[model samples]
Target: MPNQSTNGPSGRPKPECDPIKDEKMGLMREVGGQAVWSLSSCKPGFGVDQLRDNCLETYWQSDGPQPHLVNIQFRRKTTIQDVCIYADYKLDESYTPNRISVRAGNHFHDLQEVELMDLSEPNGWVVIPLKDSNDSPIRAFLIQIAVLSNHQNGRDTHIRQIKVHSPVQNSIVSVLDFPINFTTVQMAQHSTIR
Candidate 1:
């Protein structure tokens, strides 16, 4: 008789984890919903809601001229480590963003460009890490996504989704890294003699 078991000698199934499919697979905290979102222009039905609904079929369609903007503002300053944007060139074609610029600052008036990306017919989620010259995460209260151009010179743009992530320190690792504050006498006092 042929054996049909697929498990290893340990009798444990293999763990399956795909980074692309898992939205929060890394040590990062998603903070997109905590901020206020605004768009430069949008169609009646296609707006920020569609972009954040986590549905690939739905997208935020801009109706204005070139350089469409999506502004995200937070009440308090926060560290921004990465930005993920979903775009389908096959579905949206010319509406897909070809050039993107990310800006960060305390406010709109003082916004400075942090990263510039040029995509060539991207079809899935593109993650752009925001880092300073010193390789540290950017700290700001405002973040903006600017679509400078679209595929095939399209004026408007279609963004399926956007996610902002901040670096997270593992609790266990942080606890282990903490300095030992108690002296030997203090440690002994806490130990049970019985």
Candidate 2:
């Protein structure tokens, strides 16, 4: 069983993930790509997949101790300027990160520290701008949680969502191939879930 963060008439937290709000990475939809995304550790049913849903209801909850990590690898070099993280939206104060360390590079072992963010009060979603010395793209990026907020009596760190910002690569256009005799009015007559 899981402990409910809120009950009764608690208010819903602000939604920070507006996929269509930011024009840069906003207009682009999440698609299957060569980039590899992984988490160092997560509780069952809460994994990296939840981070892409754009909804706060689903999230990635970290297991074990502090310093949980989120790692990403690109198929080719990609330029990313900022990263957004939504946490504690439902008021699950426990496990919110106080400080975060960013590491990135072309190679895994060769990754270097790029930036660090210190949140005195870790409460809502944050947009962190990544700094690249050369101002160029990299092949990999990593985020490590250095400190966790006190929960009073709770376990596990919770992250409601995460988004990586980068230039839109490929645009997919779905073509509808209906019956040759089918007219526009007929095609639009009814809709099917399939």
Candidate 2 residue runs with Cα over 4 Å from true position: 1-20, 23-34, 134-155, 167-194
Residue 163 of model 2 has an lDDT of: 68
Assess the local accuracy of residue 32 in candidate 2 as a C-alpha lDDT between 0 and 100: 21
**lDDT string, candidate 1, 99-144, tens digits:** 8889999998999888887777877777777887788999999999
Q: Where does candidate 1 stray beyond 4 Å? A: 1-26, 172-187, 191-194
lDDT of 2 by residue, 93-188 (tens): 656665666677776677776656654344555656555556554335343323334344345677777766665666565444443454588675
TM-score of each: 0.81, 0.63
- Kindly provide the TM-score of model 1 when superposed on the true structure, using C-alpha atoms: 0.81
TM-score, model 2 to reference: 0.63
Model 2 steric clash pairs = none
Candidate 1 global lDDT: 0.82
Lowest-lDDT window of 10 residues in candidate 1?
1-10
CA shift of 25, model 2, Å: 8.9
Error of 1 at 104 (Å): 0.4
